[model samples]
Target: MSTPEASAVSDEVTTYIANRIGFIELERPKALNALSTGMIRGMHAALDAWREDPDVLAVVVRSQHPRAFCAGGDIRFLYESFQRGDEAARDTFFIEEYRLNHAIFTYPKPYIALMNGVVMGGGMGISQGAHRTGGLRVVTGSTRIAMPETRIGLFPDVGAGWFLARTPGALGRYLAVTGETIGPADALYAGLADAYIDDTALPALVDTLRSEVFERGVDVVACVERETAAHKVVPTPDTSPLADTRAFIDRHFALPDVAQILASLEAVSGCEEAEWAEQIVGVLRERSPLSMAVSLEVVTRAEGAMADCLRRDLDLTRTSFAHGDVVEGIRARIIDKDNAPRWRFARIEEVRADDVAQMFESPWPAAEHPLADLQG
Candidate 1:
C-alpha cells in the first residue's frame, strides 16, 4: 500500500491521496468546521488539482470535528466585516464560496460527502451538489441538517435556492421558511442524503477506502455502496417525522406567499395538526418577515440551472446586505445573543412586493455578473 502524504491545503483544511482516492478533511474543530474564505479556497484548490489527475479516481470529504461535519460559513466574520464597513471582504467570501459550490456540483469524479453530524447552511452548499453528479452523501444517526438561514435574517443562499427548490414537493419551502432542524431520517426522506450508516462504521469505511485496491474502470460509487451496506441500519417505516407531515406541509407551504401560509397555519386552530401548525406559526413569527418573503420568492422562482440560482442568490445577498434585515438579525442572534430581532417589517404581510422584486434585481449587468462564466 502506498502511504498517503498528507498536506495542509490551508490552516483549516487538509488534503491527501491514498489508494488513488483524493481526501479533503475539514480540520476547524473549534468552529465546528465553519468555512472561512481560506478554507473555501483550500477545498476548491484541492478539488481543482484532483479534477484532472488520472491517478485519483474519486474524492471524499469529511470533518475532523466529532460533533459537526460543518455547521455553516463563518457568519461572525461576515458580521465583523459588515461592522468594519468592509463590504469587499463580505462580497469576496460569498463569491469564492459560491464558486466552490459550483465546482463541487460540476466535478466529474464521484464526489462523496461523509455527512456525519451537524450539516447546515454553507455545509449543505458543499455537500448537496453531490446528488446531481452521481456522488455519494453518507449520513449517520447523529446527522442533523437544516438550512436555518431565515432564522438569522438571510434566505438560504450558497445555491440552496437551486437544490432546496428540487426537494420533495413543498418540503423545500417548509424548510426555507421555518429553518427547522431535521435528523438523519428526515434528511434521507427529503432526498438530502444518499445512504445511512452507523457513526461507528465511518472510520472503518474510511479505512476501506484507504486500503482497497481500485483497478481501472472500477465503479467508485458501487465500492462506497458496498461498504455502507455492510453496516446499514434500515430506518423504521415511520421514523421520518417529516415524511408523516408531508401532506400538511405541502398544504400550507404551497400557498402563494408567506402571509397566506401563515394565515393557513393560523386557521388550523382546532384541527388534529393544530399544535404543529401553531408551532410553525411561532417559528415564522420569530423569523425576519422580509427574509421569509424573499426566501419564498427565491425558492418559488428558482428554475432553469444551478448557475442561474447561484446568480440569483448573489444578487439577493447584495440587496440583503444593502437594504434588508440581515445585519440587525445577526446583531440580535449572534452578536448580542438577544434573540430579539427588530425586523424591518412588523409582519410578513407588510413586506412590499416591490421590495422583494428589488432583491431579485441584479446589481451588475448580465455580462458583467460575477458568475457569468459559470455554466449549467
Candidate 2:
C-alpha cells in the first residue's frame, strides 16, 4: 500500500491552489504529520513560488489530523540517515529546516499558523517562528501543545532554543530541560501560542480563508482574528503556574553547569511551588542528562546573530547523533519500547561537566561553520 501522501498527491504538491491564502496542508497523518525530506523540500518549493505569485497574499499551513499538527522530525527517516551515516542528507535537512524557520520569521506577506493540535520539536520550530507568534487567532486548543524531546535524548530544536530562550524569566529553560507538557494556558503564558480555539472551527476557517475569491486588499489576519474570536479561549492560569517553575528554573538552570542544575533541583525542597517542582522532579531525573545539559547551555548562550543559533544547533545535533544516547534512547524509548536506557549516566547528579560540555564543540571547527552558505 502506498503512503497516504503518495495516494493523495505527487511531486510534493499537496493541494497547491491559490484562491485566497495560498494553502498547503500536510496530509501524512499516519506519521502524525512528522515532516519528511519530501515534505520539507515540498514546503520550500511551494513557499518560494508563493512569495513571487501576485495573487497569493498569505499562507495557511494545516494538516488533516485532528490529533497532531506535527509531532516532530520524522525520526524513522532520521534513523535511516543515522544508520547510513549520510552526512549530506543530514546537512541538507538541517539547512532546509533552518531555512524554513527563517522564512516564517521574515515572510513578506502576513503568515499565520493554525496551531490546531499537538506541536513539538519541529512542530514548535515552525509554529513559534510564525510571523505571528502568539498570534491572535490560532484555530486549536490549549490541550495540544507540548515539548517532550528531552526524554528521548534530544534537545528541543526547530527554534525551541530561540523562542524559549526569549520567553519571560526561566520558563524557556524549564520547558526545555523538563520536556514537560502544558495545556493552552501554560502554552500561551510561555508564548508558545497566540490564541486557542477548538478543532471544530478549523474547517470553516480554512474554507473561509481559502475559498474567498476576493479583491487583493482583503485583510486576512483581521478577518481570521474577528472570525476566530468567538471561539477564543485564552488560557487564564490562576497564578502563572509557570511563575514558581520559572523562578526555580532560572535559579538553577542558569547555572554554569548542567550537573550543578541537577544537584540544585535535587536539593530544592522549600520553594513556593514545591509540589510542582517535585512533580517535575521525576521528569528531569528521567530525561537524558547529556541532552538536558546541552539544551540548558546552548539556549542560555545562543544569543548574538539569529543564524548563530541554527549553526550551533547543527553542531550539537551532529555531536549528539555520534554519541550513543540518541540510538540507545530511541531504542529503549521509541523503537523497542524498552523504557530502560542504560544511559551514559543513569543519575543526573552523576552527569559530569565535561560530559555535558562536549555537546557544544563542533567537528568542523573555525574555518567551516557548517552554515556558511547563510552568507546571502
Model 1 residue runs over 4 Å out of place are 216-218, 232-238
C-alpha TM-scores of all predictions: 0.97, 0.88
lDDT of each: 0.88, 0.69
TM-score of 1: 0.97
lDDT of 2 by residue, 1-376 (tens): 1112211254423746455456667777777788877787777777787787776667667776687777787876666787798968877787788777767665666667777667777877666766443233263663466668778887877666877788777777777888887767677677766666677877787767655544552377766776767775544643455643566677766666666766676776776656755766678778888778777876787665556777777887788788736767777787889898777777767777777768878888657775755521
- Candidate 2: list runs displaced more than 4 Å: 1-8, 11-15, 132-139, 211-218, 234-256, 270-272, 365-367
Best by TM-score: 1
- In Å, residue 22's CA in model 1 sits off its true spot by 0.8
Name the lDDT value of residue 229 in candidate 2.
71
Candidate 1 structure quality by residue, lDDT tens digits, 1-376 = 5689545566798998888888999999899999999999999999998889888888889986779999999999999998999989999999999999999999888899999889999999989988876878888878889989888899999898787788898999999999999888888888888888888888888887888788632477778888877664346424678888999999999998999999999999777899999889999999999999999888898877889889888988888988899999999999999998998898998888888898888989999999999998
